[model samples]
Target: MSRKTALLLLPGLAFLLVGFLAPAVAMLLAPPGESAGTVVSRFTEMLTDPYELRIIGRTVLLALIVTVVCVALGLPIAYLLARSTSRWGGVLLAIAIFPLLLSNVVRTFGWLVVLGANGAIGRALTASGLTDDPPQLLYTPLAIVLGLTQLFLPLAVISCYSAVAQIDPGLDDAARGLGAGRARTFWTVVFPLALPGVVVAATLVFAGSVTAYTTPYLLGGSSQRMLATQLFSYASVSVDWSAAAATALIMTILVFLVSGLSSLAARKAATS
Candidate 1:
């Protein structure tokens, strides 16, 4: 309502319009010219395409798994960083975030080496009698999930740590002093306070996992296709920009619905 506030917001509004909205509009319109058939027909084709439908389903499944894995692993690391008093906590936090500083391709290649049939993990599993032979790790759903979890875990940790850090230390102290055990205090007090951050982290992880191109492409074989791979196939291989746009739009909607429902569910859980 204020002129000064409007002035301050103008740059951001301008950037959004120029950076996101314009390009998105262009892409959406690009698809309309692809076929002589109507847009409705293209939608039908996209929906009925069995391979693409499978890719969409698999992409959602993979993203959900990646989100769960990231949160499950990130919570303890975040708790440690949030509650620790030692210099090592900061050191460890930096180490946890260190992977994010590397090129995505580099990080993915690192996983490839570790998960390869001849890699250390595979050899160790075989040597330890965990398996009769080196398990087929790469080019599987397991490999993609692991790669995605590793790629996005830092975002989850940082989000959770920021949330956990915001809670009053005194609240935790009081809970413990009131005869609650450490685990009890965490569940009753700290974790509830950190729920919002957990939701944010989940959203980030899910969105990142679903939209990722390289990790899925490299770690997953032809059978383990995701939506990003499908999008790339359409755009590059088929040279169908319109179909690619449709895929992108579908992916955006999928990410939004999943994240929105997840955040809503988290809020409801927190309230009840």
Candidate 2:
């Protein structure tokens, strides 16, 4: 490359080296007396362990649920944002994303208060004759899903909205002009174009949900043991650094796999 081109790339290269690559290398090389083979063996053993397998399954399941819920809740909001001409769209967007500005611990604690027995939801449920007792919503898998869906829905909505907004309104108008109904135009043209965004949002939600620690730890019980929480236990409680490293690697791989699969699906849909 030319000297000017090299100089232009230097800033990005320096940032990657100092901000990302350096820390990653340090993490990979930190532990002493640990061969690469030992790390691989520990990961294999974790796979073979039924409890570990259950944790992995639970983590994936929760992530899937969260992704689905985010998409379901976000699509309508995204559609509205994409269609809106009013300044209210910006206000809605701000409201949707407000939770992200808060610390994760604070957000989790907010949910804790809302879902606890004496909290608003519990009181409302009990008073409304839904149940004789305050529902045990806190420290349940449902609470975890509720909190995560709320937390991640903004990401999905923003992604989908960006994609939808990019689409030409004339396309939808032309479809309707050609006798295509609202539902037909949406499903045939709009949704197909938005598939890429949906895939992106799903991947984001899935990866975030899988690796999330604070929400699940705060809202879930023993039965909701996600892989991240288990990994934390291995590292902090058990002091099994090698195993923790292996688990971290596995989690990273899973995130990559999900992203790759989503990309492949999006490509196929785009082509078809």
Error of 2 at 105 (Å): 2.3
Clashes of each: 1, 0
TM-score of each: 0.91, 0.91
What local lDDT score does residue 103 receive in model 2, on the 0 to 100 scale? 81
Q: On a 0 to 100 scale, what is the lDDT of residue 188 in model 2?
A: 91
Tens digit of per-residue lDDT, candidate 2, span 33-119: 566677778889989999888888888988999999999888778987888788787887788778778888888899989999999
Q: Score candidate 1 by lDDT.
A: 0.87
Global Cα lDDT for candidate 2: 0.86
